[model samples]
Target: MKILLLSFILLGLYGFCLGAGGGGVSSSTSSGGGSMKETEDTKRLREGRPLILTCEQNATNLETKWTKDGNELVAGDHIQLFPNTTLYISTAQKEDKGEYSCKTGSMTEPKIFHVVELTLQKHLPKSTTVLENDKLSLSCQVQGDPELTVQWLKDGEPVEDTDNSTRLEMSDNEYDVPNAVLSIKPIQKSDSGNYVCLISLYSINVNTTTVVRVKDIYAALWPFLGIVAEVVILCLIIFIYEKRRIKANFDDSDSDPAQDVKNNVDGKKENDIRQRKH
Candidate 1:
């Protein structure tokens, strides 16, 4: 009876220990699963470049599985989990832009994530307009994380002149300062044409054209001279009218004196004749 009681006690103790161990393992798995679900996802990519995807986890030993648009990625696409947990595509095309997800074996569901969309865009400079004979300065602007290089072109030909007359200046900004200043001293009429500025970066080129019209200085001067001539003619007309009026007044005064003298003589003769008749 004593031996049987000892055996029963040992069996009961073993059962309790096994149950406690299983419960501890279940709790640990549940906590690990919760942590995987709460993992944060971040994605970023440059415009017109390849896309990069990343996965992260709070736990150190967690395994990560990557999928794209509900399809399982092959061994080539599987990215190992790290602190940063990033994957790179050599050249991200438009077709590769989509949603992605990551999951661990300890998690119940996959964590929804996204891949940065790589879009190729062409950026040109602002269109500038200036009066003829004045300095023409223009700059091309492009916004991106990485700075861009700028180039200048005139009428489909690259401007080879770098002697401050037609040169491109570089800067570390997306929009470069007036890198190119076209100085045309005493602009001639022949300078009027399509002035084009071409900006190139990473095999992508953008062009902007401005129609420059070298206004004929004579075109503006002729009208001004015409206005001045009209004013001078008007002043002469006013002076001539005043002079003619003054001359007419003087002539009328002289004629009045002669008429008065003749009238007096006639009256005296009439009186003498009347007296003789009487």
Candidate 2:
């Protein structure tokens, strides 16, 4: 009976210890689950733009520390830190993308840690000029997260690549950014407008605009017309100068005739004096 009672007590203690161990694991998992959710946050920003990461904890006057890629971040020419839990990047570069963390806490409370995966989206602005009845091509390339959807818009309406005059070429492979080319064969004057390359991923959307200017066929003739006008003016000036020179020669010839007649009368008087002497 004593041995049986001892066995029951031992079994009871073992179950109690197991229960205590299970409860501790459950409590640990609950706390870690919340931290995992917080750490899984991510943010995407456009390159060459400002990025501001702020902590929204209810605790005020908490000391905050910011770090990027396991290194502490400090204020610099392009980076700024606020008294509040805010990290400001004046201009985001490719090197600025990485894991960022913000820790905020007071002396009495536990520190709250937040982890964000920072990513930068890239786009290049373009400007194109095509002459009338000439081929036009504009390339719109972007880099970002996968599942990128691209749309080309002229003015405000969506561009139709199926049109006989327009063609759009896209990359066959899947990419985080779209590699698209918009082409218009024999582009017309009416096609001159803003062409926008819009990219969307989930709820985020970004666009880059290309200003397309169509030149008229007669645009090249403008310099030719200016040259023709200049030639006409030069010919007019030469013609007027030649006419004035001819008129001056005619006036000098008319004065020469009077001088010739005066010389002829003087010769006759000299001949008469010679004959009287003989």
lDDT, candidates in the order shown: 0.48, 0.59
lDDT of 1 by residue, 1-278 (tens): 34654555565555545433321111111110001011234244434565555555335555567778898764454233343445566655555545678776666877766543212233222223333454444333333222334455555554555223332333333333233334444444455455565543333344555554544333434444544555566667668888999999988777677889999999999999999999
TM-score of candidate 1 against the unseen true structure:
0.44
Per-candidate TM-score against the hidden true structure? 0.44, 0.47
- Candidate 2 residues 1-278, lDDT tens each? 34654555565555545433321111111110001111223456558878777764354565677778778888899888777777788888767766677776643442333222222233434456666777666555544543456777877777774343344444422233444566677677788777777666544555767677777766655555555555566667668888999999988877677879999999999999999999
Best by TM-score: 2
Give residue 253's error in model 2 in angstroms. 3.6
Angstrom error at residue 153, model 2: 1.1
- Candidate 1 clash figure, as a count: 4
Model 1 Cα shift for residue 177 (angstroms): 6.2
